[model samples]
Target chain A: MSTVAVMNGNYAAATAARLARPEVIAAYPITPQTPVVEYLTLFAAEGSLSSRMTEVESEHSAMSILSGASLAGARCYTATSSQGLALMYEPYFRASTLRLPIVMNIVNREMISPQSVWGGPQDSLTLRDAGWIQIYVEDNQEILDQTIQAFRIAEDPRVLLPINVCYDGFYLSHMTERVEVPEQAEIDAFLPPYEAKHQILDPRKPMAIDPLTSGYLVMEYRKKHMDSMAAALGVVEETDKAYAALTGRSWGGALDLYRMEDAEYAVVTLGSVTGACREMVDEKRAAGVRIGLVKVRCLRPFPKAAVAAALARVKGFGVIDRNVSFGWNTGIVYQEVRSALYESGRTLPSVPFVGGLGGEDITLGLVSKAFDEIVAAVDAGRTPQSAVWLWAPRKGVKA
Target chain B: MSALDLLAEREDMISPGISACVGCNVELTLRTVMKVLGPNSILAIPPGCMGGVGVVGWNKQSGAKVPVFFPLLDNTASMLAGIRLALDAKGRDAHVVAFAGDGATVDAGFQALSGVAERGDRIIYICYDNEGYMNTGYQRSSSTSKGSWTSTTPVSKEGQGGKRQHGKDFPMIMAMHDVPYVATASPAYIPDLVRKVEEAMKVKEGLAYIHVYNPCLTGWGIRAEESISVARLAVKTRFFPLYEARNRKFKITVPVPNPLPLEDYTSRIKKFSHLGPERIAELKDLAEERYRFLEAVSAGGGGRA
Candidate 1:
């Protein structure tokens, strides 16, 4: 008996975490992510959630508790956004390298300096090089589904790397949507109890954890850890296949192709922006336009091969990045996709359009402007030399 | 049971082939601690010398008899709290202990330490206060005594010898958290330290903070054999008074009625060799201030600073 309730993104995420029955949950409050923590504390207080809720002082301790708990061989869950994630970088860096399969929800928000608490992917995007697997979702239902799947993917023997289930903050985290919450038993069947095969804190064993290493042995650890990321590419497919077999809803591997079969031009998007682009693609398809959308779900172990294969035949493509790469003068995802395509030796004229920054809306008009740029690049037989900024004053620093 | 016999009954938890220098006081403290706690406890060691970062480096053997978790540098308190809470959730009463250095406890890790104490999380949080960032070459820490030398606080030509502020009264600060157990111990007095450990183990509820004065031979520029003597003189001079805060009321566990002069303790360690008479008098004044504060707490006046 699955409960289908209209729930906000935070509730959907909290609901999934609750059903997973994490042994330990720790988190600190930041805007857009605070509701998830609040809901978890209430669940723990009301006895609806059976887990040790560690109300830590800061996000650093929040991730630290999860790290220690996971080392204790307990399934742990936590969430944070923007500065909270920034504060927890210490433990966050260790969680993946130590191969602790802890699942954390990242309600994407803008980083500070300008001091904005709105939705943007800049937070998680900044940590793209960090060892954790990054999964961006398009909607609340997908948020609920992918969170449960994140545990399976992170804990799989092939890839015992931690994963951040990132979704747009206000757009998805605050927006309400009808989510089909699965039954506890069904989720239990999908995701088995977390058994730490990698490392465990057992007094009986009396082994050393994180001992100091010289350069030679340190290379082996680094290589082995990196090898796990490549293996994640395969584990992600199989895990999603297993989930698809259960729920009859499958996100097309890492790069979800939308009306791309024979399209002459394409636009790539991630997080919540993918949903709006999907609507645009459907409209374009109905009007006999050759435009399509490519939803990028996995940012790390970046579905390079899949992305290459999807866009190999297209005349041109554009990447809509909600985050800036700073010095590169383009979006972070656009830079990644361009690198992936370049590595694959596929030369398609590309448009790197950065919009929806700092929770600024990436409306249909802005997306249309992006699509036009991609088509213009293809028709002119040239790629844009720099990124096109949308929905902003014309007077900011270039890039 | 005799405390000596109780200590002798247990095996040496520190592997004999460990990397700690001879007469390392931290090694003595760890061995004595493991002897009392037995093999049932779990230790959450952070990136500190005691956890094998610098002085007593851990390798495959790790010199541990029980499970040891090395949390990040500033996360020992949260890690211990997490491990203990996780055990409690599983209906296990296994002891959780945090052995951290001054850098991890008094300064960088203070927030998490205070947070867990407010929650009254059951764990033995021992700050092996060697007084500075000893493992990182004796830089000044919040626990470094006033008028003492450190890499960051060197003697200047202007006649300044060391840190200007008094060494933070960390254990007293912990007592202010109103925790069930807060005590200061020194490795120089084994039986007293063992007694405090036993008492903390008995209470077995809420956070138990033990600020153990661990003399660093390398960092303090003292002879390895002088570690214990230096620690003993520290207590004899009333510089590091051995006391316990029970139910927010303080009591001097080992009182020194006719305390030795501060020079007796300062003379044993090279870290304080540059202190002039003026600095020595200031040091004596700070210890007196601490004594007055301890006396107020002993009279059940809430230990107000």
Candidate 2:
């Protein structure tokens, strides 16, 4: 039996990790992600979490510790946010390349320059190509559910790679929502204890890991890593179906569609902004406008087929990105969506929308405005060359 | 058993032939240390002389009989800590160890090592301090001695400039962390080094760190035949004293009561050839001051039981 409890996103992530029963957990504290580490340590202190927890000095050590633990055939977990993620980049990339099944919750916060720490997916999106399977969640429940499923997907023999379950900071990380905490027995039944087969650092077995390799062997390792990533797409869907069957709740595999069928236009979104977009989709439908919402859940090993197929029947679509793709003049996901469309041999009228940066709210008003632009582009049969900024001028403030 | 008998009887964990430079005492230190650690050990060889010489191996070949791997240069201690935790989780009793160089230890890898000490992670860390980044063409590291001429701290055409600062006292720093074991060993004193390694293995409660002072033959521009002698001079000159601290209780393992003149050690290495009388005297005074401090700590019992 599962217990439904009201908890914030960080607690939800921590609860999911506890249920998974990772053999080792090491994490350092960072804003937004700080509470997750606190909750985990608290669980360990209370004797509920039996994992050997290390209060690591830095995010670098946190990832390094997990990498070592995973290599030693132990299931491991950790959590971090913006700057912490940047600090762990070296070990983070190595974790995936080494193919360690470590699950990390990325409490997504914006990268600093103007120095804001509220909320954004820019942190994880900037590292989309770093080889970790990244899954962005919409709410606290999704945060709990996906983090639990993350272990299963990462430890799958066909897809033995590190994974990141990313959720927007403050928006979901601090926001309270009802979450279904799974029972220990249920989680044990779902995610079997991780058994390392490919590589392990054991004295009894005695084998070299990550030796100085020739260029040819390095290339072979990279090719195998890529193949595993491609294989993970299927594993993600299968795990989602299995979890849904056990829990009666399924976050759509890679891309979750809301009223996508029989709709002429769609607005694509990622992370917490999906909630506001979903409401706008319904609002537009009630006003007799045929529109739907496409929420991108899995960002790495991108669900190109599902995304292209979902947008196939629509006349046009608009992507709302909280993160920018510097040289492209649009958002990161907008470029990704366009690239996927190009690969599918389809060029339709589309609008690129960029807003909600540095944790500024992507309000219902902004999402509705984005949908209007998509509808306008589809009716006019002309795609905009530049991004449509979803900006709202505040009272007594200049644009 | 005597240290010599133990060494002779124990199986060498490191592979016989790889590619360490001729007469590299760091290689000697690693082989001797691993023999003490034996087969029930998981070793982390970070990027340095040992790793570059293929201690962790090239391609599919392994450089050690025990499980060995190359940890990131700055993460050896934390990685070993993880290995320890995992091994404990699986109810396996194995020595989790790291054989790294000074560049990977006192410089980039210090924080992870210090954190492990503070956290009481049951792992053994052995740092082969050959003064500088020898594998990368003798760049200056924090562990490089004062007045030494590294590639990064090069002397001028007039032989006026060298390293401006003194090398960091790293072993003392680990001792201050009050871990279960902290020791400074030397390649010249095989018995002492062997005993320290054995002592480290006996530490089941917390981190056991052994810092070995090895004079680099290739990097320090010393004759290959003079490698062990030069390392001996370092100890005789009181520049790198052999000592150990168990839970803050300090003891000089191989005490040098009548130290040799600093020139005896400095004159042997080309990196310190540029040092004049005043500079050499400064080094002598500094070593004396450090030794006096160690004496005080040893006499005072490090302020705690």
Candidate 3:
């Protein structure tokens, strides 16, 4: 096992790409994503990794380059964020619909308009309908680890679709952390080379990849994407087990539950907030408070079964979303969770807490406050409203 | 990825099931583009004429058997850049090309295209300039030459003076990027057009632009058979000069030969027939201004080598 240190999130991502050994990497770096291309270029120049890097002109071109490469049966990857991700929305959906196992790393950033460069889930959340399997990472290590795992999950012939590995910009991207740098041989043994089954760029077996389809055909194509997404749950679980065997670290397939057994209260969260909530739960448990934390690692598959089981015995459940779905009075994830539990015939009071919109911090103090509200509501024989706003400080307070 | 290979493969690669107009320049442009790009080419088209016309479905165009990526009109360049990165991840090299109309390239996609070109990405951007937005009806576009009449600029009761702006100088604008290659060609001169495409393909790196002056016979109110004649007149009258820019060096490929009077060229098209003395003078002045700008560039006046 050799050790290689990277300075920034971009460098971390590039190192992951090198270790993952992607065959084709097409990308155009925008703002935060530029460092990724810079490091990849350096890697390619130094011949540390054997990969072909196409320096495209824009984020849109970068995504399109992958569409062709993936369809041609090459293991493909790319990175972008904010307006750049918005620019790539069109093909983002197409990549998923065509079931191309292309992996993308989105350095989550807020969209421009009174423009800000801070970290947020705005970019990846906006593309929820693009048919890509999106996973949120809380730290640099998760960013590196999830990125390597994304290819395995996405390229599983059973679940052939694109994946977006998202991490908070500036926070997780620039912050330094101790990431377990896996050896190349271990990675090679864990994840096999991408072997496309039906689509290929070989002149010997020619095929037209993206042809126009009628409305009916379009519906069926989308249905297929959904079906495959559902199939990914099992694949993710299996892959997690396989990866665990290789790395000796176990990450949950759909949801990572921390100290949930015998707990009466649970907090549903994703990304970096999960880490803060985990700490709070541990502290709360020591004080004899029946509190636990459930971190959602996979967002696309919805993890309905796993979520239901996690919330099965909990008395009061609350969901914290970094993104808001206006008019729903709840975050999009809250809505999905409610629907999943409702369909599973489970009767429980789940409160929706919308916070951290546009890159606001999700502090442990906020998690404690949310728990207090839940406990007080439960004690007072009330479940509070269907949705609640958390950490919305008074006017003049900086987010 | 040579022009000749692209031309030779057109018949076999691109099938003929598209919904393009019977005499559409876009069809010809797509045919030529796919032929030269070879089999490993990824085609990213927008929701415009080319997307709607080039390949409708699997059985539609059997001509070029390659991967075709269709994105929304405004996102072609940006999406292509992403595709290039993904391809690079696999350690396999592939060419990515964006083929869009003048409206898609110069108007709706201007910012994204400019950003892409500025970065010097390794992809070829080809604009099939057919003067107007023909797919959405014959609407006048920025690329529409002065005094040309379209549905928006229909013939006035007095029968003179329609639209009055010179076509946007996109090739000149692209030269500012100092990209690896830039050229102008027309289907009327297939061999020359193919030669430029061949040269652009060989670079294999950095941004390349090829602006073709494709004539819309239906929009121009000319007989389908007069497509070549109209194109030749455009070149002869110096309205659309042919040239190439490489490594910041501008070289005029087809110089004005025995330049014909502007009236002789304008007399043949109904769109230009309404032009009176004053409007004709305006058109001539615009053409002369364009000619001088290009001539200056060719002589190394525009920061080019």
User: How many clashes (backbone N, Cα, C below 3 Å) per candidate?
Assistant: 0, 0, 48
Q: TM-score of chain B, per candidate?
A: 0.93, 0.97, 0.89
- Per-residue lDDT of model 3, residues B132-248, tens digit only: 888787788888887788888777788854676787888888888878899988777777787787788887667888999887777777777777787878888877878888966
Q: Give the number of the best model, judged by DockQ.
A: 2
For each candidate, the DockQ is 0.59, 0.84, 0.33
- Model 3 agreement with the true structure over A295-345: per-residue lDDT tens digits: 888888779888888888888678888777767767777777777788779
What TM-score does the predicted chain A of each candidate obtain versus native chain A? Answer: 0.97, 0.98, 0.93
Residue-level error in angstroms, candidate 3, position B86: 7.8
Q: Which fraction of the native contacts appears in each prediction?
A: 0.58, 0.83, 0.39
DockQ order of candidates, top first? 2, 1, 3
Worst 10 residues of 1 chain B by lDDT: B52-61
What shift in Å separates residue A107 of candidate 2 from its native position after superposition?
A: 0.5
Give the runs in model 3 whose Cα sits over 4 Å from its true position.
A1-11, A26-47, A54-57, A111-115, A392-399, B1-12, B16-18, B25-47, B54-99, B109-125, B150-164, B179-181, B198-208, B245-253, B296-305
Over A44-117, each residue of candidate 1 has an lDDT whose tens digit, in order, gives 88988998887778999988888878887788899999999999888898888888888999999999879899
When 1 and 3 are scored with lDDT, the better candidate is 1
Candidate 1: segments with Cα more than 4 A from true spot: A392-399, B53-61, B157-159, B299-305
Cα displacement (Å) at residue A206, model 3: 3.1
All candidates: TM-score = 0.96, 0.98, 0.87
lDDT for B227 (candidate 1)? 81
**Ten contiguous residues with the weakest lDDT in model 3 chain B:** B55-64
